[model samples]
Target: MKHLLALIFCVYFSGCLMGQQQAEWGNWKNWGDQEDGTYLNPIIPSDYSDIDCIQVGEDYYAISSTFQFSPGMTLLHSKDLVNWEICSNIIDDLTQISESLNWTRMDRYGRGVWAGTLRHHNGRFYLFFGTPDEGYFMTSAAHPEGPWKPLTPLLAEAGWDDCTAMWDDNGKAYFVGTHFADGYKTYLFKMAEDGKSIDRKSAVLIHSGSGREASKLIKVNGWYYLIFSEHKPGVGRYVMAKRSRKLAGSYKEERQLALPSCEAMEPNQGGIIPGKDNNWYFLTHHGTGDWSGRIVSLLPVTWVDGWPIPGEVLPQNIGAMKWSGKMPFKYTEKLSIKRSDDFDDERLAPQWQWNYQPRKEYFSLTERPGWLRLKAYRPLEADKLLKAGNTLTQRTFRKQDNDVVIKIDISNMKDGQKNGLCHFSSQHSAIGIVKEESACYLEYRKNDNITRGIPIRSQYVWLRTQWGLDSKSHYYYSLDGDNFLSFGEPYQLVWGNYRGDRIGIYCFSDKREDGFVDVDYCHYK
Candidate 1:
């Protein structure tokens, strides 16, 4: 009640945007220099950032950052944290997050899965996430790899992100997450017993004291432990643990949690579960600079008299932990990758899908012919509202910083046939090209200097985009197959009504007669 009144007072006095009342994503931070990948940049797979995990039986189920892509929750089941694969998305049923493909901060385009909570209790598995821009949502299933239920948006205090769940022994349930709508101030709260809502009656803890507060609650040895993160990126000060006899107060904080010794410190939103061996461990996602290609990192947790301690930090290495593909006789194991999609395949790889309602007739392909044909007839804007879709992108947040280059050839094009590459956040500012009557036109200038549609002479042109952190992105069109030309401005990707980052391919037709872009093949190099 007081918080609500305070929020109302702040809104009236601050002239801030109507929201959770905190400062968020737009904060200026320069993180483009971590390009060398030489120094221990622990955040390698920046694709799935801000992770929450749980151990179910012998398997470990984890979820992470989704700046709003379809199938919002990327669910992975692993035997060993080393080798991971997509089992199912916890949000397969929610058309809003899926069809809307709501992203993070419009600047964080095409990113959908963020700080998801995955757990299994009494034969049922539940997955929860903070659509920071849209409150909280969750789903459940009989198994980790399952036909997850539709996304259920829960009651969340305004101005919050990274909401996670917990169950206390006294038959009480709780959810925790923080928001910074007010400049940089962060606050924490508890969820209701039903788990579908944030308990307004519960006490609130404004995070003004010791640690980075994307916190997790765990009960061990009859005492409750609060394991948390301090916001430093790759360098240490990342993880910490606190405990209290009661749920709301009487808590003590640990001085230092992890000691990786890097230049960053963004150990955020975490989860813990007892393995089959009864050994407890910490599961977290490490931030790769300011770029949100979040990666999954595991730490075996140690506890002392109910207080949780993060385990030893592993040396940083990229895809270096090569465990056997599928091992037996284990506490946690990895599943085979279900992400390999061959455009030649008749159907879209179960894992690869469009953001919203896909006009299936617009696409065609033959396994024997080895090419995917998309007739470009509809104007890209008509198919996509003031939002973004009509493009093929992937959940690349936890995958880390790497240039993705797509190569495809067009057999022919009509004056209305517009097809090219897209790095989208919203409809306002996006970059791509349209081949009209054999001449290539870029979607630029109108989008301001952010993304300009430049026209160049050529029957065949190679369109490329270099998307990176610090909003560092560039578009290039090469008329001469050998060299490339940089377009007018470098797009600093920004999210729209919501927050997200998207990298994909788009084709549209505004004419009554439909036409399309027949992509011979595409390669991510």
Candidate 2:
């Protein structure tokens, strides 16, 4: 069983990817990767460029780009504006809109659905999103685990998109969306009561919308502040604002609070969630890895000189948020899900999901009394990354530079058979494996480049992905002992299509026949 568990992950890329390299004749485990514990700007992980977040009631929620990956809109929740975790993703499959929409397999490229918006009103949640290359859409569900209604195009046209919305105090609803290209030009309009469709004739272009475009309305003490931006990508776009006496009136420019950390990303329009207590915080992000590594940041909004400013640095409210700031809110040191999978339960954890809508027979270890069996799907091509059919994955939410371990016990893995683990976004994915030949291999693919085939001794293979704020990533392969072989370069753990990397396991086949792989445990440190 141990060998079976190990061998399943030993199969490397179909070809030898361990290109010519100097072999270090030392204890393989000697090449241990450790976290420097250094922190960088845009604290949390994500490249969800066109981002929009909302604080509903006491709980805060957010959504970003899914690009080609169906079951889109990775939803997030947070108590203190800083530390956030995945709550539920809204889509199960793109079956309703365009079933053939997956560019993650093309150049394994191009953006899918870019910027997204999350809005809550009258006890229901609303999500507005758009594929920059496709068109704009709006979908909703009572809860995040959406039976989400079919997708509907919000605007008559859809180029590059950024959509923002808010429910005004006088029982009125408004939507502000923008089109992107050389520069962003925005228009404000009223939405139908249902919040799914908008009044196109009511749309009005309010800004030059240069750089990036976005706007959200939040009023306080009778003053209505229109938050918008002219965020030019490189030169440090400002999170400027305009104030109007009324919700949809002519306003004036405010001020710039936070700038891009590294000179690449400037401040763009972040969603403003007005708390029940009347205070507001801005949910936004900045660039990290060469326009690729962008992450989410949060801040309290403070008004000085008649303009809004992000109260503290970035994510000044992560985990241990202050109630008033003078007296610290004392609680536990820190909190995060360490590990789970007592598959002893009847249903799968909320965090686990197949690539798209999955069926009962597709996978279920219960039949094997704790063995995970995933039917074979397809030979993964560059164009159908997640669409390769049966990819079961989860988001890597922890911020620590940790290692992930998965236990697999598969029987006959031969004749175009495949069973492996993966860290996937839209375009980037990787795995460590034991193929039918009994040889162990570590395989990884990002965009057009695939680096793989570093050998391991035993089939009991442990493949790990590690990174920190610096976001430099390394893959390590280990056998019986904790000793591991470090393969691949220090590839930055940047965003792929429109989201961050999600790790899980897969069983694919060209025949489209379902194959099964049983997994025991998965430990993330």
Among these predictions, the greatest TM-score belongs to 2
Q: Give lDDT tens digits, candidate 1, residues 313-394.
A: 2231101111112111243322444432447777555455455444556667762256566656453344342233355666
Give the whole-model CA lDDT for all candidates, comma-separated.
Answer: 0.51, 0.55
Q: lDDT at 191 for candidate 2?
A: 85
Model 1 scores worst on lDDT over the 10 consecutive residues at: 317-326
Give candidate 1's whole-model lDDT. Answer: 0.51
Question: By TM-score, how accurate is candidate 2?
Answer: 0.74
Off by over 4 Å in 2: 1-51, 102-110, 144-148, 181-183, 252-269, 274-280, 288-292, 311-361, 365-371, 380-387, 395-400, 423-429, 434-461, 467-495, 500-504, 510-514
Candidates in order, TM-scores: namely: 0.65, 0.74
In the order shown, what is each candidate's alpha-carbon RMSD? 10.2, 12.1
